[model samples]
Target chain A: MKCEQISELLPDYLQGSLSPDQRRTVETHLEQCADCSEEVAIWQKLSLLPVEQPGPASRARFEAVLQAYQAGRSNQPAHNSQWRKRFSSWNVFHWLRSPLGAAAWSAALLAIGIFAGLRLAGPKPPSPDLAAMQSELANMKQLVVLSMLQQQSASARLEGVTWSTRDQQLDPRVLSALLHTLRYDPSVDVRLAALDALSRHSAQPQVRSSVVSALQEQQSPLVQVALIDQLVEWHDRDARPHLEKLRQSPNLNPAVRQRADRAISKLN
Target chain B: MTLAPDEDLMLQVRDGAGEMLGVLFDRYQTPLFNFYSKLTGDRTLSEDLVQEVFLRILKYRQSYRPGTPFRAWIYQIARNARVDHFRKFPRQTALEPEMLPPVVPSDSAQEQQEVELLRRALRMLPEDKREILLLCRFQELKYEEIAALLGCELNTVRTRIHRALQELRKSFHQLTKGTAS
Candidate 1:
C-alpha cells in the first residue's frame, strides 16, 4: 500500500486501536517506507521531552484562589445574585412604605424648608470661608475612605479602594492605607481593587515603590498579575530587577511569574 | 478498592464538596502543565493556566452533569482558559532559538542532537497543527474526546492529526538533513 493509503490507518495505529489485520498492513508499510516510519519514530521520540512539574507553590496559590472565590461566593450567593438584587430593592420599597419612613421623610423636607428660609432671609455668613470649607469636604471624603478601608466586609473595603481613586490629590494617610491594602488585604478582590486605584497614582514615587514591593509580597496570583501589568503600563524599567527577583522567588504563582517575565521583556 | 472516578469527585465538588477539588488538581496538574508548556513554550503561563482551569472548574462546576466525562470536560475548560488568556494578552514575542526548552541530557550525543532538532521542528509547525498534535500526543486525549473538545467531527480530528504528522515529519527530515550537510 502507498504511504497515503496507510496514512489513514497510521494515526489509529499509533493510538494502538487498529484491527489486527490493519496493524499488520501498517507494520509492513513501515518496514518499507522510511518517511512514514520516521513519523512514527518522531511520535515516539516526543516522550523524550521531559515533563515539567509546576512549582511547589502551585497548590498554595490554588488554595488562596479557592478561598477567595468561596469568600466572594458566600458574600453574594452564586446564581442568586440577581435574586439578591431584586430582594434588596423590594426591601427598600417596603421600608419606605412604613409609617416611620413617612415621618422621617416629612422631617427631612421640613428641615430643608427651614434651612432654605434661614439662608434666604438671614445674613449669608460672609461667603462661607470657601477654601477652608472645600478643604474640610476633601478631608471628609478621605475620612470616609479611611473608615471604609477598615470595614470588615471585603466589598466595603473594595468600595473604599474605589473611593480613594475619586480624588485628584490623595491624603498621605489614605495613600498609605491603600498601599497596605495592596500588600496585605486578606481578600484578593480588595487587593486587586487597591492596585487598580493606586495604578492611576503612579506619578507618585511612593506608589511605584510600594507596588514593586507588593509584587514581591503578594501571594495571590491575581494581584501579582495586576501589579506587574501596572508596572509594565507605567514603563518603569527600574521594576526589572524586582520582577527578576519575583521570577526567582521560590513558590511564586505561575501566572504572576509569567506576567513578570512579560513585563520585564516589554520594559526592556 | 477502586479510586473514586473523576466524574464522581467532580460531582461531589459540584454538590459542594470543595475538598474534592484537591484530588482532581493533584491528578491533573502535571499533565496539564506539560500541555500548556509544550504548546506555548512558556512554563509560567502554562502553570498559571493550570490554576485557571481549576478555578474555572469551580466557577462552572454547576454546568457539569452526572454523565459527562470529567477528563473531556476539564480539557474543554482547559482549551477555553488558554484561548481566553491569549485573547486578553496577545502574543508579543515569537519563540526564538534562545527560548527553546533547555536540551535535556541524554544517553548519546546523537539522541541529544535529534531531540534539539525535534523541538525546533515542532516549534516550526503552525500553532493550530501544533495544538492538534499536542492534544493527541502529549495530552493523551482520545480522538473522540478531541473531536468533542474541538467541536469537530471524529474523522476530521484524525485527518488533522495525520496532516500535522506529515508537516512535522517533513520539518524534522529537512532539519536533520540540513544539520547533516
Candidate 2:
C-alpha cells in the first residue's frame, strides 16, 4: 500500500476496525516503518483519554439542573390544566351516577367504610403486627412510585399526589413522600402526618429507630408528641433509651412528656 | 400518577408544556457539557454551548418526535450548535496542548508533555477531520450515529475518522522530530 492509502486506514487500523486484508497490509507496513507505528500509538492515546467519566463539578452541575427543574415545576400550575379539562369533558361524576357506576362507587365506599370501622373498633390500640406489615407495604410502594416518577414528568406526578387521597398502607409512593416530608418538611403538621404514616411501620427496627431519632431531633412539640405516641405502640425495648431521653428533656412539651412517660411505663 | 416517560415529557414540551423542558435539560446537561468540553478544548465555551443547546432544544421542541431516542435527538442539537459556533469564530489553527491550559497533571511530566503534544497535534487538523476523530475516538460514538448526526454515510464517518487519526499521527511525529533535534 502507498503511504497515503495506508495513512488513511491508520485510524481504522488503530481501532481494529480494518478488514483482515487491510490489517495485514498495515501490520506489514508498520513492521518496516517506525513513523507509521508511532502515528498509530498517538491515535491510540487520543482514543484512550478518559472522556466518559465527568468530573465532580459536572456532576454538581447536573444536580443543580435537576433541582432547578424541580423548582421550575413547582412554580407552574400544580396540575395539567388541559388534562383536567379533558377529564371534565369525560364527566366522571356523570358516569359514576349511572346504575353500574353508582354500584361500583357504592361498593368502593362500603368497603372503605367497613375497613375503617373494623380498624377503629378492633384497634383502640394499634396492632404491632398489622402496623409493621402496612409500613413494609408502604415502603415497597414508595420505591415503585419513585421509579415511576423518575420516568414521568414532574407535573403529572405532582397532580397524582395532589388529587389522590393519601393511602399510607397500600401506596408505598405516598408513604415514601410522607417519609421524605417527615424528614425535611417545613410544616410541623405535615411532618407530624408523615410521622403518623411512618409509625405504622415502627415494628421494623429501622422505622422505630428513625422515629426515635426524629423525636429527639425535632424541635416541634407536636411532632415530638406524635413520635411519642408512635413509640408507645412500638412497645420495643429499643425505644427505651429515646423514651428516657424524652422524659428528662425539660424543653419537651408537657403533653409530649406525659406521652413519653406512659410509653416508658409500657416499655418497662 | 406515574411520572411521564421520556417521550411523554418531550411531547409535553412540544405541546407547550414549557416547564417540562427543564426535565429534558436536567437529564442531558452534564453529558452534553462534557462532550462539548472535549470537543472545543474550552470549558467556558463548553458551558455556553450546553446552555445554547438546551435553549435551542426548547425553541425547536415543536419539531421533535416523541418516539425518537432522546439522547440522539439532543446530541444532534448539540452537534449543530458546535457547528454554528465554529462558523462564527473560525480558529486560527487547531489548538496545541500548550495553547489549552492544563486540566490535571499526568504521572510524569515527560508522559504529560507527550500527551499534550498529541493533543496539540490533534488541534492542528482540519475541523471536519478533528470533529470526526473526536466523535469516534474521543466520544466513542458509533459510526452510524456519527453518520446520522453529521448527515453522512456510515462508511464516510469511518473514512473521515481514519483520515483524521492519520493526520494527527503525522503531526505528532513532526513534533517528536523537532523535540529530538
Candidate 3:
C-alpha cells in the first residue's frame, strides 16, 4: 500500500475494523517502513492512555437538572404559565390579562369590522390602494412572526414558526428567519416547525438551498428525517451530496440512514 | 419479549413521560461528562455543560422521533452545547494541565513520566485534533458513528483521526525533546 493509503487505513487498523486483506496490506507496509511503524506505535500508546474520570458533582448536577425538569413536568400550571409568560403577546390571554389592553383590542377589532362592512357595502372594484393596505397588513404580520421566531423561549419560537405558515406569501425576511431557526434553533421542535414553515417555500431556489444546507447542520434525527423527506418529496437533486454524506456516517439513526440511502438512490 | 432500547425510552420521554429521562440521565451523565471533561479539560465547566445538555434534551424531547437512535441524538446535543460554550468563552484555552484533573495514577517512575508526557501532548494539540482523538479513543465511538455525528463522510473522519494522532505524536515528541533539553 502507498503511504497515503496506509495512513488512511491506520485509524481502522487501530480500531480492528480493517478487512483481513486491508490489514495484511497495512501490516506489510508497516514492516518495511520504519516511519509508519513508529507512527503506528504512537497511536497504540496514545490509545492506552486513561480517560479522565468525572467527579460526583457531575452526577449531582445532572440530578439537579433532572429534578428541575421533572418538577416542571409534574406541575401542569407552571408549564402553561411559563409558556404564556414567554409568548403572551402571541396569545389572546396576554391581552385579556389586562382589562385596558382587552378593551383597546376590542375597540380596534370593532373598527376593523366597521371598515370591512363599509368596503363590502361599496362593492367597488379592487383598488390599488386597498391592495397596498392589505399587503402592508401582511407585511406587519410577517414581521411579528419573524420577531416572535427570534425569541429565546422555545414555545414562543414554535408559535412564530406556526404563524409563519399561515401567510399566503412569505416575505424574504420571513424566509431568512425560518432558515436561521432551522439551522441554529436550540430546540428541536422549533427547528422542525421552521422546517414545516420553510417547506411551503421550498419551490424558491434560495429556500431550497437553505433547507439543503441545513441537512448537514441538523443533529436532531427527527429534523434530519423531516429534511430528508422534504428533499425527496421536492426531488431536489441538490440534496444528493448531503444525503450521501449522511449515508456514509456510521452513527446516524438507522432509520435516517435508511431514508438517506433511499433518498440518494431516488435522487440519483 | 425484548426490552425497549434507549431510543424507546427517549420516545417515552418525548411523549410526556418526563420522568423517564432520569433513567437516561443516570445512564449517560458520566459518559457525557467525561466527554466534556476531556474535550474542555475543565471539570466544573464540563459538569455545567453536561447539565446544559440534559436540560436541552428535556426541553427538546417533543422533537425526538421514535425510531431514531438516542445516542446520536444526545451526543449531537452535547456537541452543540460544547460548541456554544466554546463560542461564548472564546478566550478560554481548550486543555490546560492545571485545570485538567489527573488520569489514573501510574506506578513506576518512568511510566508516570511517560503518562504525564502523553497527557501534556494531548492537551497541547489543537482543539479539533484533540476532540477527534477523544471521540475515537476515549468516547469509544466508531469512525462511522463519529462521521455520522459530525455530518461528514466516513473516510473523511478516518483520515482526520489518522492525522490527529500523527499531530499528537509530533507534539509528544516535541515535549519530550524539550524536557530532555
Write model 1 residue lDDT over A56-150, tens digit each, in one string.
98888787766655544455444332322333545445544555445545555565565555557757633555454456556656766786687
Instruction: Sort the predicted structures by lDDT, highest score first.
Output: 1, 3, 2
Q: Considering lDDT, which of the candidate structures 2 and 3 is the better prediction for this target?
A: 3
Candidate 2 lDDT tens digits, A85-140: 43453444544565544655565566556556657776463677457555554444
lDDT of 1 by residue, B2-92 (tens): 9999999998888767778999999999989988887888888898799879977875676798999998999899999889777756798
Q: Which of the numbered candidates is closest to the native, going by highest TM-score?
A: 3
Global lDDT of each candidate: 0.79, 0.62, 0.74
Instruction: List candidate 2 segments past 4 Å from native.
Output: A1-39, A48-268, B1-31, B54-63, B84-109
Instruction: Name the runs in model 1 displaced over 4 angstroms.
Output: A73-268, B97-108
* Pairs of colliding residues, candidate 3: A250-B144, A251-B145
Each model's number of backbone clashes?
Answer: 0, 10, 2
Q: Model 2 chain A — which ten-residue stretch has the worst lDDT? A: A147-156
Candidate with maximal DockQ: 1
Rank all candidate structures by their TM-score, best first, as comma-separated numbers: 3, 1, 2
Per-prediction TM-score, please? 0.59, 0.45, 0.60
The per-residue C-alpha lDDT of model 2 at residue A8 equals: 73
